[model samples]
Target: MGGYCGYLATVGGLAAGADAAYIYEEPFDIRDLQSNVKHLTEKMKTSIQRGLVLRNENCSENYTTDFIYQLYSEEGKGVFDCRKNVLGHMQQGGAPSPFDRNFGTKIAAKAMQWISKKLKEFYREGHVFANSEDSACLLGMRRRALVFQPVIQLKDETDFVHRIPKEQWWLRLRPLMKILAKYKTSYDVSDSGQLEHIRVSSPW
Candidate 1:
């Protein structure tokens, strides 16, 4: 869940009743694999101690669930039961919520309207509609409004290497989400002068 629209996916995980959601906001590096696994396992230890179900969303392109599951299991000393469910070829497939259904309908309606207008103008001009920002735009909801953005501009804003948008609006909600989930993150300096994160139980 830490790739592409990971923030939104993290929200969906929370909505699905996960006790805690771990979102990977940064890109995964092979050099940091060991440290990353240790870090995640340490975080999961806190959730396990509190008897909470945890869900981690990471970029599949960088690492697979197997890597995390296997490493986490080894770190857990066979005490924690780790399970993995693979939904092949399903893009978050499940029963659509009312809000999602409504949003889809609205988007479709608006898209058809826009296409119809373009078709009418094209016929009126008796010439092919040139590919421009107006002709090639993505209609999406941004901040509760249906905004259209040029594909060219979006391409420029994309992290081509990662194949995700460079700027994600939902990232701002990461801290708030963690706070609401009762995830208290505390930091401390070890004897080796290394920084370490220690999870503290939330009062609320």
Candidate 2:
């Protein structure tokens, strides 16, 4: 589930009375989405038996959340009420968050320093123009620390086909989210000798 906040919306679902959240990164599969909806509807039935009501607000690619709600509505007929909440480009056109403003300022200052140093090196070498790996670099945080990575050097770490980074830092937190949300999964070996995870019903 995606939009301005992307996968963060799934994390926020906990506050909206979600028992668990299923997140799919880039290259989302329709099959997986359908499976997740089936499982979620089953869980909702269990919740209804426990005298609990649920509402959801998922964010993602345009109309993706709407599709999800529609699936729930169809599956949960006479079981629970499901509806879509449109936010109109949710949280868009607002001033940048305080943390964003501060972090951006820091990165800009560091980039300026790098540019000044590069200029000084060019002047010392008596070069009319400079073209090097350092000449074109990206300035930003890596693992909570500011880092400068040359664009040319990121080829091995870039997924050109998907137009995204191969190593996404936040993906590591997904498993933690499942754990905190009480998603109990068990692995089973298939006939083809492949292991697959089977989700167990959660009491939440």
Candidate 3:
């Protein structure tokens, strides 16, 4: 979730009243800035405490097309004893399994319900929101029900729009994706939809 999906997640998380969004900090590693490669001292840790660090002037993960972000690294946080996990290919390209199907159905149903409710409210209030800024309401989950969120607290714009907020819980898990990405066979081992047979030594 480091690209467009990441952006949407950040905006959605903010709209949903999150304290802060977890984005990759600048200078993920000091070695990225070196003209010639030196011995890499900053090693990847297993815990959130040691895995992330503070953003430095040399970090490149802080940039976004639409919004500026204040990113922090897992190393800088000094929270060691990190644990990492991934759901892998099934999440990206595999067929939808039972849990995925069920969860998707539930979320989709709630989204439709929110849109219906929005149109009904708009009709009754005689307010029409045609612009993206006004109509782009953030949808969120409140308890078991799907709720609406506004980024800028534009009460007037809420007259018409349905939007689902981002999943911050998942957003927080994004860093692990990068850490484990080194081991994923999909990155360099797989080419032309065929997986290579040789064993990979180090992705880095």
Best by lDDT: 1
Model 1 score (lDDT): 0.59
Task: Report the lDDT tens digits of candidate 2 across residue range 1-204.
Answer: 132223554545544445445443533455655655555556565644321212223323443655666766786677666655655566465788899899989988998898888888777556646687778888868778999998889989887764556666554444444454344454354554443555666545
Candidate 3's residue-wise lDDT over 57-123, tens digit each?
Answer: 2214443311121212233234223232222233355677897798778878877887786676556
Write down the worst ten-residue block by lDDT for model 1: 47-56
lDDT against the true structure, per candidate, is 0.59, 0.57, 0.38
Each candidate structure's TM-score, on Cα atoms with residue i matched to residue i, is 0.64, 0.64, 0.32
Task: Give candidates' CA RMSD values in order.
Answer: 6.9, 6.3, 16.6
Task: Write the candidate numbers in order of decreasing TM-score.
Answer: 2, 1, 3
lDDT preference between candidates 1 and 2, better one: 1
Candidate 1 lDDT over residue span 1-204, tens digit each: 334447655666556534444445545455445543444455555744422333344454446668656755675564455566654446566899999899999999999998888777666456766555688889998888998787887987888876677776655544444455444454454554444555666444
Candidate 2's displacement at residue 119, Å, is: 1.2
What TM-score does model 2 achieve against the real structure? 0.64
- Cα error, residue 17 of model 3, in Å, equals 32
Off-target runs (Cα >4 Å) in candidate 2 are 1-66, 85-89, 124-128, 184-204
